[model samples]
Target: MPGGTDSKSGRIGAITTGTREAGRLPVLFLHGVGSDKSVWMPQLAHFGGDRMAIAADYPGYGDSDFVEGATRADYARAMLGLLDRLEVDRVVVCGLSLGGIIALEMALFAPERIAGLVIANSFARHPEGEAIYDRSVAGARDMGMAALAKARAPMLLGKDPPEGLAEEVIEVMSAIPPEAYVLGAEAVWRADLTQHLHRIACPALVLCGSEDAVTPPQLSDELAAALPSARREDIAGAGHLSNAERAEAFNLSVDAFLSDLDEKP
Candidate 1:
């Protein structure tokens, strides 16, 4: 919504920017649960040069098509469809939280389509994901999305998060359909990509907020440790929503990593 045009009802929704260049890989963004394409505005602005940059909304989360009971695989397939529609041969996929897990699935399912990866504030899987999701689904079932958004938004930021960020996050999250919320929680809760990390052959960057309470630094440390070609960076004073809380730092770190990859022979 912020980086590109939104679909006029009934059309599939995606935020796309930059001019497509032959032989140049696009930068594709996948956002976390309760978030949509708009969250990647900072990244799109930073990366949308001559190369393609896109931030897409998952089904039921935005203007995208809704598929009840969607799995992570479904999300990955949707991404593939987006790429195909855009004539993109390959992409540098970047994802945050639930989006990050989805990125891993994309690597597992279609490794050839990905040139590089960025996993931020995410884990292979949550150890107590079952209980966490159960409570979450139940809460949504009872209180509704607005209430859930208001309740959950605070836990995702640092002691003093970026101004206006919480409100923005809540607004996006509150718009999610109940079914999609339930389905998303289940998919993330069930994900276990530990064994598959070795299969991700592309260069990867792992990021975490030093103050992140949702997915702590230890989780990112483990992911960085497991990835074959990877580096870890921590953003001080940021929390679960690191990109939003510290957009300048996050963008700089990612830009440096992508620039380094561009220099490769």
Candidate 2:
């Protein structure tokens, strides 16, 4: 919940964010590892102006200066800080990949304030593959961005990725300090929210790209089923970063979900 000049507790750093003021609910966008709020550009364009939607970079990513002593908890704090700054009492949150995990953490930390949620391409518990985290740290340490991107960039995109986005992803990730990116990956692999799903009281949406080999649709289904108030959707022909790869269809699903929310009266 960070903001401009008049913060009470402190600052959440120079966060990069996108906003739309006309929609019913304020929407907060959270990006995944090694990426920034810009990842949601297409969705922002689709939903902006008429929708109160926002996308923000985590402290260390994008144009924001990195916060020292950073951890996932710090990420949540920073988002809450923004909410405080914006004078928003409640919001619908949407997040993909690592961003989804942060959104979940926000719900857990402040259930009373979250109106709804859309969690995509994420998991309650990371499946097997200790080696993925280990290798991420190693590759970042030794060979730098190219090596890490070579290892990671393929699985993140669909079978046939968009024309220029691969390079775009690589460029963003390449800007990250190798050690820092490794820290983020380790945080993702170490994440565990298995016991916390039942506590999420806000209305929620769970979705995954049909082609997401990372967390997969099964994980989304599991989360949806476990939640007291959650609906799950699957997007065809998209992968881990489905929101970016197939933004239009993804936005349609999101727009429909939000539309349903608007009709609740």
Q: Residues 12-129, candidate 2, lDDT per residue (tens digit)?
A: 4333234544446778888888687778888777776566567776665665556655677777767877777677778888988788888999999999888889999988777753
Query: Model 1 Cα displacement at 28 (Å)?
Result: 0.6
Misplaced by over 4 Å in model 2 are: 1-23, 263-265
lDDT of 1 at 80: 75
Candidate 2 lDDT score relative to the true structure: 0.77
lDDT of 1: 0.84
Candidates in order have lDDT scores of 0.84, 0.77
- Give RMSD to native, each candidate: 2.9, 2.9
Off by over 4 Å in 1: 1-11, 21-24, 263-265
Q: Which candidate tops lDDT?
A: 1
Provide TM-scores for the models: 0.93, 0.90
Model 1 / residue 141 / CA error / Å: 0.6
